[model samples]
Target: MSILYLVKKNDELISHCKCEESLVGDPGQLDCPWCGCGWLFSCTKCRKAFTFAEAKEIDKTWEELAREDLLGYSGKEPELEDINSWIDCMQNMVSHIEAGKTYIYLDGCFIPADEENFEFEGWKSKHNFYKTPQVIALKDKDIIDEVLSNPQYWEENIIQEQ
Candidate 1:
C-alpha cells in the first residue's frame, strides 16, 4: 500500500500526494505541491512530507501530532477496537475526498454532488455508484449480495452514466 502525504493550513486540508514510502528527503529542499509557497518537511511518524511552520513553535512536528491525533498512540500496541476506529476514520477521510464529485446511481441515474439543491426523489436516489443499492425485488438476493459485497465487483462494474 502507498503512503499518503497531506499538507494542512489552519486545520484545513490544502494539499495531498501519494507516496510509496516515507518522504524523508532533505528538508527545505522540496516545495509543497498544493500551495507552492512553503517548503516541505518530512513527518517523523509517517515519514510523509508536509509544509507547516506551527510544528516548530510547539517543539513538535505537525506530522507527529497528526499521527497522534489519528492513531491515538500511547506508545503501546493498539487494541483491536482502536484499530477498527482508525480504519473507520480513514474511510471517512477518503469519503470526504470524494464529497464534491458527481455520482451515478445503480439505476443509471445521475446525481450532482451539490448539497444545497440535492433532493431524494426515491429510494433509488439514496445509493451512489461507489455504494451498491439493495435490490430487494430480485429473487436471488444471496448471489447479488455476495457479488456486490466484493470489492472486485465495484472495480469492474463502474458504469459511466451520462
Candidate 2:
C-alpha cells in the first residue's frame, strides 16, 4: 500500500510524496516531491536526518560486529557476545536505512514474507530464489523523484538473473 504525505513549507502544502509501506515501513523516510531534500527518516533520539558520513560509519560498525560475531569464536554454540554483536549490527543497519542515509534496492519482484513457498517451480522441479541487492545512487535527486513517481520502475528495469 502507498501513502501520500503532504510536504509543507510555512504551514502550507507545497507538494506531496508517495511511500510504499511494504518497502519502507511507518516512520520510514521518503524524498519530498517538491524539494529534493529528504524529510522522512530521522533519528529517534536527536530527530535529525542521518548523513552519508553517519551511514558509512554505521556500515563499518556493522561489518566489524559481523566479523566478530562470525569469526571471533570457534565454538559450536554461539556466545552471548557473538549474538549481541549480530543483533547490534542488524539494529544499526535498520536505523541507518530508517534515517534515509542509505537505500536498499532488491533486484527482483517483491515477495510477501508470509508466503510459504518462495521458490520457482519449473519442469516438476523447485528452484530456490533469492533477491539480489543492487547499489543505487540515492545522491541523485532526479533518481529519487523518478522512483517516487513510479515504484514499479525498479522492478521492471532490474530483474534478478536466475
Candidate 3:
C-alpha cells in the first residue's frame, strides 16, 4: 500500500497526498513524482502549504526525518566527529544555495560503505538495483511563475485518477 498523508486544519482533514511506489518510481526518492511536492503539501481547501515546521506540531518524530533528508548524509552511518564535520559542510552549502543548480539528496550514497567490499565478486550485481537519489533545482523566478500558471497542471486528468 502507498503512504497517504492527511492535511488537516482545526483537526479536520482538508486534503491528502499519497506516495504510491509505482508513481514514485524510486523508493528512496524524496519527491512525489505526481505532484512534485517534495514532502510539502498544498491543502486543496485553505490552500495552506504544510511544511516540516508544521509537521513538528503533529508529530515530533518528523524533526529527525526532516534533518536527515534535507541536510544530506552518507549511506553508511558516520562517527560522532564525522557527523560534526558533515553538519558544517551542509551549513556551508545552505548558505550557497542558488537558482539553476541541482541539489541532490543522498548524493553521498554513490560512495559505497566499503569500497573493498564492493570489489568482491557479485557485490555490484547485488547492489545495482538500488534506487538512485533524487534531485531538485530552482529555475528562474519568472519561469517558475509561468509554469505555476499553466492550466494543464491543474486539469482533472493530469495525474491518473485514484
Candidate 4:
C-alpha cells in the first residue's frame, strides 16, 4: 500500500527534478521524490532526506529500498498488480495515523496492518509498515515542527524510568 509516502526537506517537499509534486505516485513517478536535484529522500514530517553528499551512492539503491519498504517487493525485480488493494490497505492504515508524525504506508501481498499490531507471530515476514507518529499534534504545535526540531521526538517524548 505504498501510497507514495511523502518526504520533505527544510519544511518543504523535495520537488521532483521534473514532476515537482510533493508526492510522486508509483510506476509513473519516474523523477526525483519531488525535486530532481539529487538522490536524497526527505521524510515529509522531518523535511530531511539522505544528505546530498550521499546522493550518488543512494541512487543505486534508493528506489529498490523504497520498493521493498513500500510494497514489500524485492530490490531486483518486482511484480505489478492492481493498486486498489494498496489503496484499501492504505485507507485502513491511515485510520490509525496519529498526529505529530508521518506514516510510511508499507504494504505488500497482504495489508501490513492486518496482522496484530502489524506483526505476524513474532516475526515480520514481509515489511509494509508506515513510520507514523503517536501524536500528529501537540499543544497547538504542528507535529512536523516537532519532528523538525527533533527527529527522535518519539524517543525523546518517551519517559525513561529507573
Tell me the whole-model lDDT of each prediction, alpha carbons only: 0.31, 0.29, 0.26, 0.29
Each candidate's TM vs. the true structure? 0.24, 0.23, 0.20, 0.23
Report model 1's TM-score to 2 decimal places. Answer: 0.24
Task: Write model 4 residue lDDT over 32-120, tens digit each, in one string.
Answer: 21231122333322232321111011222334433443443223434434344444443443344333333332111112212233432
Give the range of the ten consecutive residues with the poorest summed lDDT in model 2.
5-14
lDDT of 3 by residue, 58-104 (tens): 23232232344333333444455654554454333234333222222
TM-score of 4: 0.23
Among residues 3 or more apart in sequence or in different chains, the pairs in candidate 1 whose N, CA or C atoms overlap within 3 Å are none
* C-alpha positional error of residue 2 in candidate 4 after TM-score superposition, expressed in Å: 18
- Pairwise TM-score winner, candidates 2 and 3: 2
**Number of the predicted model whose lDDT against the real structure is largest:** 1
Write the candidate numbers in order of decreasing lDDT: 1, 2, 4, 3
Model 3 regions more than 4 Å off: 1-77, 97-162
Q: In model 4, which range of ten residues has the least summed lDDT? A: 51-60
lDDT of 2: 0.29
How big is the positional error of residue 129 in model 2, measured in Å on the Cα after superposition?
23
lDDT (0-100) at residue 154 of candidate 1? 41
